[model samples]
Target: MSEVVETTDCTNGTTTTYDVVVEDARIVTPNEVVRGSVAVDDGRIVAVETGEFDADGDTHIDADGRVLMPGLIDLHGDDIEQHLYPRSNAAVDPPMALASADRANISSGITTKFHAIAFEDNPEKDRSPELAMDLVESIRSNDSLLADHRIHARCEITDAPCIDAVEEVLVNDAASLVSVMSHVPGKGQFRNIEKFREYYENDANLSVEEADELIEERISLTEAELSTRIDRIVTAARDSGVVVASHDDETPVEVERLDDRGIDISEYPITLDAAQRARDLGMFTAMGAPNLVRGGSQWGNLATEEAIEEDVADALLADYHPPSLLAAPFVDTGETLSTRVARVTKNPADAVGLTDRGRVKEGARADLILVDPEPTPVVEHALVDGEPVYKAEAPR
Candidate 1:
């Protein structure tokens, strides 16, 4: 499947070349999966041809007849926060948490991840604007990160003080995506008031009465300043060439409103009607992969499988779990493998304006993952920009 080809190094007057050629694998492209070999030179895919490559250099990954697909692009994931706070009161160092998340992501086949950091004022814990800014800076400055780290700032519409913080990231070009969200009990992710109360009590340590009062307060505050703040945040993000999303859209009217405001994506629409409306309005509808894997929503919203069946869901996010992205694609979605894979790969990449590295093609950045798609889907190796960042020691 692989052969050695020598070339002269003129400067040293000797034969030397170390290009990598991955051969004898089924490479999944944007169009179709073909049995081929891919040649990489300087972190770019130079060739994708049938059968084996007659030339090779330093490394030749045989792939052992596994599936070689483009590395996943997670649009919205909060797994970093989970690593940052493994327990309710336990907190780890930001860099250490981020490093741990990076290993998990790459091993799960995610080569590019947008770490969803919320810039909000919450009574529960320390998701302060200052912390968000610091985390963003940490992610941006950490060159040792294996995955391509980026920020997705979830701006709480009712948190008026967070506007300046969100704006700072956009103006400074630190955020790749921004989503406007409202967590009032009667709307968004808390459509079921009981679920909202449960989360408030458990996560925020609020009593029943206190949770009710905070919900009412949030509703009033959101109603008073939603329009103006939404406009300001959306305008700033768009001006910075960052993609904007509407989070937890609950109805068709809400989708229409966000569509009018030039939202590029609708994240986790709570109902089938909302998801359909989002697609009809030409906005990409993203549902959590965990919903599909768990067979339903944890907070009692529309099931992702139902949304996929209705052909309304266009993209999938890791949401709170990074491994869900790898597992969700293998579920029986009544679609081709390429189509299901695109929900995590090309769809999210295109929605977030990443024009390269989502598909296996000539001239694209060689961000790829090799998987064993059998009894259980497993990520065998993860490569970012033609370099192997994670490789499984055994079948997993």
Candidate 2:
């Protein structure tokens, strides 16, 4: 339990007060870890001291050397879809699923989440055009939540018909980020056509013939039509100040074309050459935190560790797993803890044009988490905008 407290400085005949103070923490900075305490007031960090705060804070905690780091900013996570459709064919109310998604993310120390919703032409519950529209509207309207929620509308260029819905979301301010994706039989993440068939059949619950026919539909999409659709998306996004990203850049040429189209973020570059090209072209390259945590890519593409080692990976997202985002900073990538933390924090914030709330410095937003790294870096406490949002309860 925490209570408000005040202390008097008799020498100066004055009192110093802070809204919150966390002491004895191994604070993570951008370059180095410092053993110190942090003071917060009015939703911002006001001071960081080498030792304990000389003045008392109203709400105080003894961190006991736990790791205090900035709250994670996840640019791509579809974990909410997991809650929205908990079962294979069952559906839950959007509000209930949203509440579940909020708790899961806050507990995992993700403060800024760009919830990914696919506006593709699909039949699945979560990715269907109907569901995506509903979700974007639902998430944009819902107000009560612990973590920050924004929409990342994923548009499949192969399905040119959905451009209307994509543009609608952009025009209506439902989605702030748009990703251009193409999952044709022999391109992007589905380049391994056989694996694509298997995965597609499983996800859509289709037989071999049905899946192949669907792939044929994607393959039949004319390049000119797809190019026109991409232009429409890029132009709308640019006019609306929405960030646009390229998905699964598999080659240097692919990276170049997207860069020329003004796509600034490369999400999940499948090869080292592509990731390197994105970096050279000044685009932020994002890989999945799950890939880094699990030591390899699920699709056997460019390994997350390999990208990190090559200094081409600038940010990490949760991809399909929220918990992996919290664990990614602890992975050993031959970088200092501070730099590793940057993969999820400062770098991500910068990638999205957010100039604040990603580092432990004075004048930064007090979006922070205390992690007990004994077992696997569990979040013990989380503060968003200087307010306690989550605290782990332990058995007495």
Candidate 3:
């Protein structure tokens, strides 16, 4: 399954040849899966066809009939927080944490990642506006990362201080995606006050009374102020051509409001009704892959599998675990393998406005992963832009 293709190098005024050939791969695309080889030249997929081609190449990879699919496009994942703050009081340098996360992402078959950074003004949590801004800077300035890294600012609406920070990031062109979220006790992910209390106490080490007091203070803000700040943030993000998403939408009304504000994606809609309404309004709906793997949402919300069954979910996000992106397609989703794979690949890429990469097709970016799904799914090889970024060695 090797191919030889010819090309003309206009700048050099000479004819060139294919650089690499990935042979004998079970290439998985959005439409079908076929045993074939892929030809790459200058970091783009030049051809994908069955059978062997009598063409020479500079490098040859024996895919060995492994599943070669597009590298994952993760629209939302916060696993970097774990590497950044491995312990309660211990924190790693931002660049070091990001570099570690990049390796983990490429190892997990993620070629494009949007690191969800929460911008909250919580005194108890370390997710401050300054830290979020710093992460944006660190992710943008670093060029040695394996995966294509982008910032997805989780703008906590109640955190008034974060509004300016969001504006600044947009102005500086640092963030590629922005999602407006409100985690007050009575709504969104915290609709269950007791669950909210437990989470606050456990994460921030706050007493129940302290958590309640903080909730009360957060809810005390006037609706007018919150609405105004949200409008400003959304406007700025939209003006800057950043993809806008709504997080934890709980009702049709919420979905409609976000839709009216030009939100392109709805993340983690809490109820089936909300997800359905978001879909009806032409908004792409995303759910956590971890929820699908765990069989239920951790917070007793809408299950990911159920959402997919009901045709309310358009994409699956890694959420807190990068490995979940590749593992989710193997779950019992009651859908075709191609459909399941699209939830983590093509659908998310479309939702995030990335049109070039997500499928194994001709004239597309050569971001692909060779996976062995038997026993356990393992990323045997990961290629970003036709270059091998991660290659697993043979087991003993």
Candidate 4:
């Protein structure tokens, strides 16, 4: 946990004046939104009210009715390491990747993120096990990285060569979440052979001959062997006290099995049946916020907005896009913006067991964003742990 800052001076007999007073801001908490003033003493929220506030200190900001809420938490976004370093054959500077990704998250209002690094030892893809390890090492050593970056090891269960590498990540890095993804042929995400073929062919830039050979080579794991491997990984993860998530669960059976095995989060459940089952089993149904903002899934998975409207989905990941997290509320869900905003803020924090920082309340960490909302949604200011990390350039 980070230290909270404190100050002296208060309005209405409050104990101290806030370090900064965001006056007349549209404050959105989990319960409600208020047209009021927020008092920040040190780096904690000391006062939040709907009425007028007397001047306590010199520092103040006028939000002009833009939405003010907790910073968005991205549960599973691959925008950083994977997208930035697409080729295992090529090496990009790790510090550049970290700094660039942090700025990208700040622009998206994602103050906290679990940078998804897929565990793969393939020589063809640029993402070698060694490179992945280096990426984690580089980010963990740097304290000046913009967002509160955490790790999410997207462990590919079929990658036997990378099992030790996954274990290394768990032991060495701050892996907040571990997701089990099985991409073997005729199972998991590649359940349909044609669809699977299309994905590998079009997405991976693999020739038809190469794709066929790769599919044939994936036959090393028998069904029983695959099941055993998954169990071993899940057991190791649970023993380490890491949050475990099941990826792309496609059916009620899949949900039930994962739920029985103590999986706490379901990432992108492929069907309504699986999503609903996860919700009923007290597991969070993590959908892509991009799906909500885009009005549907990009590749035809379950739409997040529909799941939210139906009360089946509990949280949203930025998935591949960081900007979608902040843009999700403005997607016109017919409900008030306050209500829609909770899906990205309060719901996700709760889903991931982060209780103290999600709402604008007394004593909560001042993880906040000021949105400039006339021409576009611009993040005018951002704070993490009560310190201003991002402030927009003043107009000339």
Question: How much is 393 displaced in model 3, in angstroms?
Answer: 3.4
Clashing pairs in 1: none
Task: Write model 3 residue lDDT over 271-338, tens digit each, in one string.
Answer: 99999999999999999999998889988899998999899989999999988888998786667778
RMSD of each: 3.6, 1.8, 3.8, 3.1
The lowest-lDDT stretch of 10 consecutive residues in candidate 4 is 1-10
lDDT of 2 by residue, 92-144 (tens): 98889988999999888899989888877767434677788888878888988
Candidate 3 weakest lDDT stretch, 10 residues: 1-10
Residue pairs of candidate 4 with colliding backbone atoms: 9-16, 9-17, 18-40, 19-40, 87-126, 88-126
Q: Clashing pairs in model 2?
A: none
Model 1 lowest lDDT segment of ten: 1-10
Candidate 1 — which residues are off by over 4 angstroms?
Answer: 1-18, 222-224
Q: Which stretches of candidate 3 lie over 4 Å from their true place?
A: 1-16
What is each predicted model's overall lDDT from 0 to 1?
A: 0.86, 0.87, 0.87, 0.77
The 10-residue segment of model 2 with minimum total lDDT is 121-130
Writing each residue's lDDT as its tens digit, candidate 1 over 1-396 gives 134456675656775444677788888888888898887777878888887556566567788778989899998998888888888668898999999999999988999999999998773655788878878988988999899999999998878889889998999999999999888776778877787888889887888898888877886774537878989999999899999999999999989988988898999999999999998889999999999999999877889999999999998999988888998888998888889888999989888878787888888888888888777778887779877678784733
Better of 2 and 4 by lDDT: 2
Best by TM-score: 2
**TM-scores for every candidate against the unseen true structure:** 0.93, 0.96, 0.94, 0.90
Query: Once superposed on the true structure, which residue ranges of model 4 sit more than 4 Å away at CA?
Result: 1-15, 56-59, 86-90, 374-376, 393-396
Residue 376 lDDT (model 3) = 65
Between candidates 1 and 2, the lDDT winner? 2
